[model samples]
Target: MTDKPNESSEPTPPRTQPVVSGQAAPSPYDSPTGEIPVVKSGAGENVPRTEDELGLDPEVPGVGERTEPIANRPAEEPTEPVTPAYAFASIPPAPAAGEGGLRRRGDYRRGTLDLGLLGLRLVVGLTFLYHGLQKLAGWFHGPGLDQTRAMLEQGGWKHGELSTAMLSVAEVGGGALIVLGLATPLAAGAVLASITDAWLWKQGMAPGFQYKPVELESILVGLAATLILTGPGRLSFDRNRGWATRPMWGSVTALVLALIAAAASWIYLHGGNPFTGFFD
Candidate 1:
């Protein structure tokens, strides 16, 4: 007998489907629409489809389809645009001077200078006050107003008694004000005028610069003028009471009044002609 070769009965495995990231691949043995599974035959192989199944797509064999990979899919919605948020910061302002007892601009209230100036005011003011008392009230062995008037007449004052009395009043009043550091400009003006007249009187009568006749008067004028330039010290009544005001215009006004008073005093002393020549 001739031996015929028997056929081995193993079925061929189906081809693998291509995989996408977010999508599932169709099964190899599944129908085109993936609705039904293919059945196996007695020979252990996929059952062949009928003409009706092939009618759906003549070229493709199973449920597997040619599609774009998940990496290239455009189904994802576009990301939303981001917006930034902001908040305003709050800042505080500095305190004002008047509100907290702070100094204003141009206020010169140095402690050391105030102490020195206060000492100066005391010495000058008290000395002038005493001298005024001597003339006005005959205190401290002074030539009373009557005697002072005679001395003034000898010095060529048009009205010696009136002039001497007026000088006494200014000296006494101004000296007291200076000592108290009240109305500093007014006090300085009065004292400045008085000293200016004294200097002119000495220059006119003495006629020569042999000796500095108005030495004490010049010193007094300098001190008074300095006080006008610099306000009273912190230890005075004016400062404690908030009256120690020293503005630029105040100084200017004090100087102008002093000069006018000096001119008037010179005129009263010698009939408006105190000097004989330019140098004199």
Candidate 2:
């Protein structure tokens, strides 16, 4: 009773505990063993292992189960190679002769000038042949031999008859020979003589060069001379036979004949006549 002391009336004091230094408070992320719990986010959260990673035999089926990785599979095999549609390639081997014999290591050339000569020959020959037919058949506006003779007389050709005959023969015979690739040099020389004579008589000295002799006949004479100097080439019939390959004496004879013809034409055109001094 000694002042059972208003125990109920006394205020309860707060309980105090001893404090330890450097000790941190426990968090919800802390584990019982003091290790932090790892919570991965995004694609890395629930990735699976493959058969090779799990040490399973790849050859055995169903013996070991594994979650297959989507990216771990091998890529699809590529399709076989194919030739293009526009390609002109052939599978069969080309013929041996088609290659023009076996080319030596240093002998092959990517381009050639010989083909140009062949092309020229073909074009000129065909043109002359067509011209000959025009004269023969009167297909175009070309004059016949008789009318050509009259024109030659008007041009002061004293022997107009003979000149006309020779021109007709050269045009028809030489053109045919050229087209056939036979006696190419002779045919070219004949055509050259006729054309040269025509230029000198009709076009060269004419007033104002009305017919354009220097422009047109110069190119014609050059082409004809080129053909005369160079043989028709390997693709021609002359090469197939041994006849066209004549001795140097043949060329010398042709040269002499050409000089004489040219001199005769000059005398007829400008010098009146070689034998007579009177002008036409």
Local distance difference test values of all predictions, in order: 0.76, 0.63
Give the candidate number with the greatest lDDT: 1
Clashes of 1: 0
Cα lDDT tens digits, model 2, 1-280, are: 5855455766899888756679876667676677555655596673335576466656664646775565897787999989566567578656775364654323334255446657767766766666665555555787776777687677667787777777777767877776667888788778777767656665534544354545666676667666666556655678654323332556556545664676676676444432222232
Error of 1 at 57 (Å): 40
- Model 1 scores a C-alpha lDDT of 0.76
Using TM-score, give the best candidate's number.
Answer: 1
The CA root-mean-square deviation of candidate 2, after full C-alpha superposition on the true structure, stands at 19.3
TM-score of each: 0.59, 0.50
Once model 2 is optimally superposed onto the true structure by TM-score, how far is the C-alpha of residue 43 displaced, in angstroms? Answer: 99
